[model samples]
Target: MASCKFLFIYPDINEFSHAYDGNNGCYYYGIAQLSSVLKRVGVETGLLHYTLRPAKEKFLNDIDNFTPDIIGFSSTTMMIADVYEWVRWIRESGRHSPLVLGGSHATLDYKRVAADGLFDVIFIGESEESIVEYCQHYRERPTNILGTVVKGDNDYIFNPARVLEQNLDRYPFPDWTLFDYESLYDMKTHKRGILMAARGCPYRCSFCSNDRYADLYRNKGKILRIKTVDYVIREAKAMKIQYPAINYFQFVEDTVGFDRIWLKEFSERWPREVGMDFYANLNVNVCNDDTIKLLALAGCRRLQIGVETGNESRRKEILKKPVLNKTIEAVVKECHKHDIDVNSLNMIGLPFESEENILETIHFNARLKPKLLQCTIFYPFPHTSLYDYCVEHKLISESNLSRTDYFRESILENPKISQEALYFFRDNFKTLIKIYRYVNIDWLIRLVGYKRAGKIIRLFRTRSELKKWLYQPRKKLLKYV
Candidate 1:
């Protein structure tokens, strides 16, 4: 039989607000690794990344040119609606190739995906080995594959569960050959290389998908796993050789410091061997003075830490991240001391969360004075604990659930806090932080606290002229020297 060819489709639709020239900072390592595995076995692979929705003809023409035996789609919860539309279009065009759906969405909601009958196979959890096995036996139409849910004559074939890959170094580095690295690197401001040194997060944050995904493979094996420090350094060196333009790397793990031993070894060797700065996410609950120092020694330029909410009780009870405010402050202080830039991630518009609570979050970030303050309207992703809570409270609007771009807007029908109020907070959150940071509001914050300070900022937020004057770019006048 001829070698099977696969086409990987990724819908990176960010609602088209940002530019999408096929390289807008969205890299799917799963698909890249899958392509590598296929190539190692002499199978052919192609990728059609759609940053924007394409015309039907364009989509069809690209597929026709490749003529892949299998078409696979990797999507997050945000891209599911668009994926459904594209799959339907493919079916309407009389294509007979087997369709596969994988990624976070499929792994978390395999039952729903299988019930839809849109895909011939739905891969759950890790698909690196499963995919190669599927391609090898696609002609046989076997249904007993460990990690797949395959379509049957009458119903779906639920295969036995597959275990997680504890040893990450078992597989080769991701196939960057599948992507246009030069174009991607050119579009990026930092010319950063993206790499994932680990597999999972240890904490089970309610709003995050990690907890839900972990429960899916409860008895399989250890959920959180990391590659050896030597393996990671080797990958980094190879990445530098492949793309000499890459000045630094961004390790895109949910949390990178869970294993301090692994981190210590990496920190010691990374700068000495690679000689480039890097950035990675750190859980505030896991970070300490020593961790920050180790990271700085490794040439870590910035660290992204989550400060999801300011209401301590809500953070613990609602979000399941039982970290103290003082703990967060100390972590930020250590990061600052080490000259590691901190980007604090926050969320607003949580269920049953009051305006004052949101203000507390803003005020809290201002106090920490992180180099970057990032906020997003809370989006209760499907299958997450928060999603179930929102559903139980009848706050979810099924009609408006189509869009998952929480950064743009909220879809909750929250009674305590209106969507309009949520929008107001999201729109002005950064500006409020700026006011607290630059302007003299320490007295007001100390005296009136979060609620009253929020009122004053709300008034300021309404005045566009004042905002424009405060933040407008100043022109550099030419002077003869």
Candidate 2:
């Protein structure tokens, strides 16, 4: 019998996930999840990073010691150049290990990355099946693999895409033992382990890369899939037993409450079983009063939803979220009614985004009075509607891979909206949100919540009574596209 070592690299880039970059200090414990997944398939995995200024020689030594047959990496779009450095280093080692690149960047631009020959394969979609299959087969047949692009004999045959829209429960519970949890958590503001219950999102907001996962599973389009309730609960319980002291359960489900049955069942069973606070992106289309009721009961502490814009035109035209303005009104009101702690995601700098659009988003968000409001500058990522639009319209001067993050504004020329205008939009609206949260919103809080439940108490007799709040003539968000 022969054995192979696989090194899954979460390259020690300066930035973390979408939320942990720049000003906000956050910890990433995803290595634990990734490692657990690998272990499920009978593979030994280790992480390689030079985070603490570890010498280049020390890094080289570790790579030599591992002597891996395959090296897999996960990265954000902006971190591709950073990946290049690591790839260069690995290549320099002269071992020529088969490199496997996954994560958002590679998922979005697998062909370009594979064509460069930096990696032996690019795992296109959700990696559980494809990756595990590839690793096991690599022990026998390394080249001709499924669900990825490999360095085939005479041509680069990118395998027809497939989305691994499978039962999440089938995979092994993430091995939390693999992470430097305390070391990583000690340096951050928010600390807790995260688990994924489902894969893919059905919605197609223009600014979002939601389909990235489905793109990997199959070349054809499809909606999201969830891990079964029993499977999800089993993992949740197993993780609780494993972590013991973990108080927060963070789920990376693109939209957590998409199904009312799962939400209600999880909510009902969570407290008695896992008893942890959780945070996830909840889709407005799926959530209603009953869903919020279940979530609150289930020990969910935070619900993050996007109110990308308030402008009717922007919401439908630019944002491409089927959410009607009225639906947004109902969703926010319902969340507040249930007293669910809420965070609203807002973005500025869509190519044609104007000050009027910004104002509309702000005015609309003000109605919900979310516990936290984040305003992010948009970065055009590969394979999204927004990215195509920007490229086609020649919205920016040049597209530099370096500017895929918040570090720089649009590098493209002829940007429909100026960088100055984007920041101005953020500044004008964000300040109001800051001030509202910091000082004068106590009265508003009472209106949205109820007592004895530690949740949102309804201010009106029924949702219909809140009609005034949703459709007030004076308060209507009249901001523009």
TM-score per model over all chains: 0.90, 0.81
RMSD of 1: 5.9
Lowest-lDDT window of 10 residues in candidate 1? Answer: 472-481
Q: C-alpha displacement of 84 in model 1, angstroms? A: 1.1
Q: What digit string (tens of lDDT, one per residue) describes model 2 on residues 7-117? A: 866654444334444322333344565666677667888776434334567766887787788888787777777677778887886867787788877778887787778
Q: lDDT per residue, candidate 1, 309-356, as tens digits?
A: 989999999999999999999999998898999999999988889878
All candidates' lDDT scores?
A: 0.82, 0.65
How high is the lDDT of residue 7 in model 2? 85
Native-referenced Cα lDDT, model 2: 0.65
Relative to the true structure, candidate 1 reaches a TM of: 0.90
| Steric clash count of candidate 2 | 24
Going through the candidates in order, what is the number of backbone clashes in each?
Answer: 0, 24
